[model samples]
Structures are given as structure tokens and as C-alpha cells.
Target chain A: MDENPATAPLPANGPLDGDPGLQPERTALAWGRTLLTLIAASAMSLRWLPDQGPFVLAMFGLTIAAGSGIYLTQRRRYRRSVEGIRAGRLAPDAAAVFWTAGACVALGAVGVWLVLS
Target chain B: MTVPSTSTPPPGSVPRRSRFAEKILPGGTEPDPRFTLANERTFLAWIRTSLALLAGGIAVEAFTTDVFPEPVRRGLSVLLLLLGMLLSAGSAIRWLRVESSLRSNRPLPLPLIGPLLAAGCAVAAAVVIAVVVLG
Candidate 1:
């Protein structure tokens, strides 16, 4: 049987479905805080790169990429979260957490290297 | 694709989507998704702490390059940077543990790394205090 497929409601729970929770927005804001913290740290470390060359520049690039990644993903995350909330199935975002945490470790390693050499 | 309606549903079998996330949080769906968000925020907070320590290391090295004995100054900076690395790496483990526990309906695990990080920061501070006092 052939059926028309254009009339289904979008997969979203109504605004009141979850009782006024702002968890997705708060999670995004928490990421914003993490991004700000990382940017500040990158700026702080930039002082030492006056003569240290490309290794340091790479650190700057790392943090910038991390910032831009989180920035770009924010809208997508927020939108997908609405659908997830509506459907009651929000999975943990372990890879995003892993990457952000990896950036921190890389930045810390760069910091240590800058101090030592 | 319809999932079987067991009381405990298995995680999706699509490992190709994310190898990194495949086992990070095991033990079925979280009972409440809000707690998962809280866990993510806490992980972010730990990362912020890591960044703060990294900045502190840079600040000490940049500002005090010659004010103290070279070894002492470099040592403090190194210590802070090391602490930052530990915090950064540990945050993910902490997040996974909490998420797993939340999913399994268990009490949260004891904060095995949090107090150690605090103590490490204290030691770094005491070193600076010792330097300022002795000279």
C-alpha cells in the first residue's frame, strides 16, 4: 500500500511535557563556561610564545579549534536534546566529553613543556 | 528499528557510530536524563579546574621567571601543570563512573580524585609560601 508521508507531527514533546526543566540549556551553558575557561588559559599561556615557535602556535591552534568545535556544536546539541527530551532518551555524550578533556590534557602538556624548556 | 521492551534495554549495537562512546557509559539507560546532564556539567567543571591550574602554571612561570631561585620557580610551575593534567584526565573517568552508577541505580562512587587534587594544590601553594618566607 502506498501512503502519503508528509502529515506526521515533528518528533518533539510539547513544551510542558517535561515540567519546565532547562537541563539542556544549562548543560550548554556549562560547556560555555568550560570554553571560556579554556580560552582564558590559552591566552595566559600565549605570553610565553614570544620566542618559543611553532609548538606554542600549535597550542593556540588546539584551543581555538576546541573553542570553534564547541561553538559550532552548541545549536545542534540543543536541538537534538529537545527531541531527546521529548522522546525520553538522552544518551550520554561521552565522545564530546572525551575530546574536550583531551584538549585540556594537551594544553596542560604544552604548559609543562613551556615551563621546562 | 524497534527495540525489545525488556525492563533493561541494551545499548544500541551500532559501534561504528562512535567507538569512543561505545563503552564509556554502560548499564542501560539512565533512570533520569537530568542527572546525566548534571554529570556532564560536573565533568565540565573539573575541566575548568584543570584549565585554571594550567593558567596558574603559566602565570607563575611568566611573572616570576627571575624573582625566585630558578629551580624553585620552575618546580612550582611544573607541579601546577601536572595537577592540571591529572584533573583533565580524571574528569572523564569520574563522569563515566557516575553515569554508570546512575544508570544502575547505585549510590554515587566516592570522589577518589577530588580530594587528592585539592591536596596537590595545597602543596603547590605551600611551596610558594616557603619560598617567600625563606627569602
Candidate 2:
């Protein structure tokens, strides 16, 4: 409690419990893995560029944008999670889960179109 | 029933969170942060599974152009893609249900997605194997 809330530095290894390296770290890494999988799916869409022309590029763009949104906010999320844990009020982020689902649906639609057309 | 708290809060009070959050957050007593975090990880795992399915669909379509007949390949690819879409959407619902259950101290819901995914993948594999054996 002595450390100023605003000025307290983030943990070097990432925000984790005093017990050291557990739940929060695992969750953070899960997000990271999800981001990587999304990027891989996005890149795979590029293989359709020649076959589907520019339409497939849109899928790539949308998928990458979604991935970027998650990537950029990761640090903020980690910080909030640590603070929420300490305060005993971890707010569940339904929007993040929903938007990720939406992005996957979009990607799947695009893939189906590419395959069928 | 109690009246909503409409009176203005004192200065420096934490503002109310979004309506979306209010709906989900107000119902359950606060669960352990670690449990909440674990739930988040499970949701992320499902997302990854969806992405993996999408990647498989793309790879099948992109690389198997000559291996399987056009109609057969397209059918398999579309099947996988649709499953990917289904899983991604379902996982979000699953996450919410689990969170709510945790809050209310109910037993966690059975993951209906598991059987659906297994069946979908099995069908896709069977189609591939049939094509390989027949043609």
C-alpha cells in the first residue's frame, strides 16, 4: 500500500501475484497465444489473394485490425487485472470475448466465400 | 424491490461501470480473482481453437486445389469454416455462462461446444478419407 498507485512500476516479468508467477501470468500468456493464432489466420488469408483478388485482402485487413486492437490494449489489460486483483473486484470483460468471436465469424465467412467462389 | 441509486455520489467516488458490465457484474458475489482469471484463460483457449479451425480451412482450400476434386475440396473447406464460425460464437456464450455460474456459486455448465467440435472434425476427416480411398 505504500507504493503510489499511479507511479508504481509494472512488474518486470508482468503483473503477477505476491505468491509470484501464476494465474494472471497464465491468463496474459493465453491472450498472447490467442493473438498469435489470430495473426496466423490473418496471414493464411493472404494465400487467397491471387484466387479471390482484393476481396480476400479485406479479410486480412479486418483480421489484422482485430489482432492489433487486442495487442495494443494488452498492457492496459494486464495493469487493470493486477489492480483489480488487489482491490478484489476483477471486472469481467465480456466485450473482448464477444468482439473476438465476431472477428472469427467474419474470418470464417470470408473463408467460406473464398472456397465456394 | 429497492429503488435505483440515483443520487449523485461524493467527489472522488468511483464512477459506475458500463451498463453491459452492470448486467453481468451485479448478480454474482465476487469470486476469487484467480478463478476469474482461469475462466478468462479458458475463453481465450476457445478463441484459439476457433482460429486454428479457420487456419485449417484456409490451408485445405489453398493447398488441396489439385489433391481433391473441386467440389469435394470446397465442401470440406466450407464445413470446417462453418465449424470455426460456430465455435467462435459459441465460446463467447460459454464464457458468459461460466462467469455467471461462478458468481452465483452454481456448478459450471457442461461445455456443449466439445461434442459439436468433435463431431464436426470427425465428419471432415471422414470426408477426406473417403475421397482419398475412392479417388
Candidate 3:
């Protein structure tokens, strides 16, 4: 077992080999940008909702809730990635992708129905 | 040549020189900076997609009313709002998955959203056509 943390075997080939810190920083920044975008979009949705006040409010509420989840999840993800790199064991994350894709499809379907009906 | 770890390599590692090297090349060593950048770019692309969906929802809710019935307009507004929420949620989830894969050094997970998105778009289009043709 490599005693040196710096030279410790990586769990997987992550982005930063030379400087382990750099990749994590980039990933964090990416998440930050994503968070900002979602927040802005949510604000727009809240403001633009029409005469159907309750429905619009409900949707906006959900957006805010989801945004909070994203913010928290991103932070946790950064920490976990860092840990995985340090420990030398790669953890799998397929569930997140599946959830995201499913959500997108559902949203698209709902949007289209709204537009046409 | 024994290179000092203190100094960074110029860029991407030298191309894989052997079959075993190729297998390890993709997952054996820490990912390259370029890979990180590429992953981030992919994430941003997904975010853009989500934003577009959000914008689309808002646009449909606001503009379609000019030509649609009152019930239809209201329905569209609700639907668009729901869509926006869905996009935001989806993008966040996707980001998490990508980040995890990058850290683990495993093969990037296959995207499952493509079919769902395509199907959703198809359904939406059909509904729009029906509305236009029936009206």
C-alpha cells in the first residue's frame, strides 16, 4: 500500500493526474455555473407564469426546491469525487443519469401538451 | 526517462503504445486535463439544453394564447411551467452523474435521456399538429 497520499493509487483515471486539485476545481466551477443558470431560469419562470396563479406558483416552487437539491448535490459530489480519488476506489453513479433523462422526457411531454392544448 | 512528478507534463499523456496501455490509458491513470474540460463542456451543453426547455415552456405559455382557446392557453401555461421544472431537475441530476464518473475513472455512463427526449418531442409535435389541423 502506498503510504504517501499524494502518490496514492487513484481510484480511477480522473481528470487531474499531475495536479489532483485542478480537476476538482474545474468540476466545482462547472457546477457553480449550472446553479446560477438554474436560479436565473427559475426566477424567469416565476415571473412569467400567467393568470393561472396557483399552477404557476406550484411549478415555481418545484423549481426552487429542485434548485436547492442541485446546489446541495453538487457540493456533495465534489467532496465525494475528491474522496474517491484519495481512496483509490471508483464509485458508480448510473442512477443520477437515469433520473435526469427521465425527468427531461416527462417535462418535454408536459410542455408539448401545454402548448398544443 | 524518469520525469519529476513536481513538474507537470506538457499536455495529454503520450498516446497509448500497447493493447494493455490502451485499456489502462482510458482508466488506469488519472484523467487528463483535456478530459476534465471536455466533461465540463458536456455539462454546460446539458445546462443549455435545460435552459432552452425552460425558455420554450415560458414562450409557449405566453405566446400561444394569441391563437389558442382560453382553456388551451391555460393548459399550455401549466404544461410549460411543469416542463421548466423537469428540465432544471434533469440537468442537475445529469451533472451529478457525470461528475461521479469522472472521479471514479470508470467508463462514462451511457446517456438514457436521448430516447425520452425524442419521444417527448414527438408527442409534443403530434399534439401541436392535431391542434392546428383540427382548428
The DockQ leader among the candidates is 1
> Model 3: residues >4 Å from true position, as ranges?
A1-21, B1-44, B63-135
Off by over 4 Å in 2: A1-16, A19-21, B1-17, B24-26
Q: Which 10 consecutive residues of model 2 chain B have the lowest summed lDDT?
A: B1-10
Per-residue lDDT tens digits for candidate 2, residues B44-135, read: 99989988999999898888878989888888888999999999999998998998899899999999999999999999999989998999
TM-score of each: 0.85, 0.86, 0.49
Q: Pick the candidate with the highest lDDT.
A: 2
Q: Write the per-residue lDDT of candidate 1 for residues A1-117, one digit (tens) a residue.
A: 211111224536645235266878988899888888898898887777777868778889889999999999999777655544544456678889889989989988988888888
lDDT of 1 by residue, B1-135 (tens): 122122322244111224555566544554555677788999998889888998888888888867988899899989998999998999988988888888788899987778979899899989989999998
All candidates: DockQ: 0.43, 0.42, 0.10
lDDT of 2 by residue, A12-103 (tens): 78444442445556777788899899989879878777767689877788878998998898888777666555544566877788888899
Task: Write the number of the candidate with greater DockQ, choosing between 1 and 2.
Answer: 1
Considering summed lDDT, which 10 consecutive residues are worst modelled in model 3 chain A?
A87-96
Chain A TM-scores, candidates in order: 0.83, 0.81, 0.63
Q: Which 10 successive residues of model 3 chain B have the least lDDT summed?
A: B1-10
Q: Considering TM-score, which of the candidate structures 1 and 3 is the better prediction for this target?
A: 1
Q: Which TM-score values does chain B get in all models?
A: 0.82, 0.85, 0.67
Q: Is candidate 2 or candidate 3 better by lDDT?
A: 2
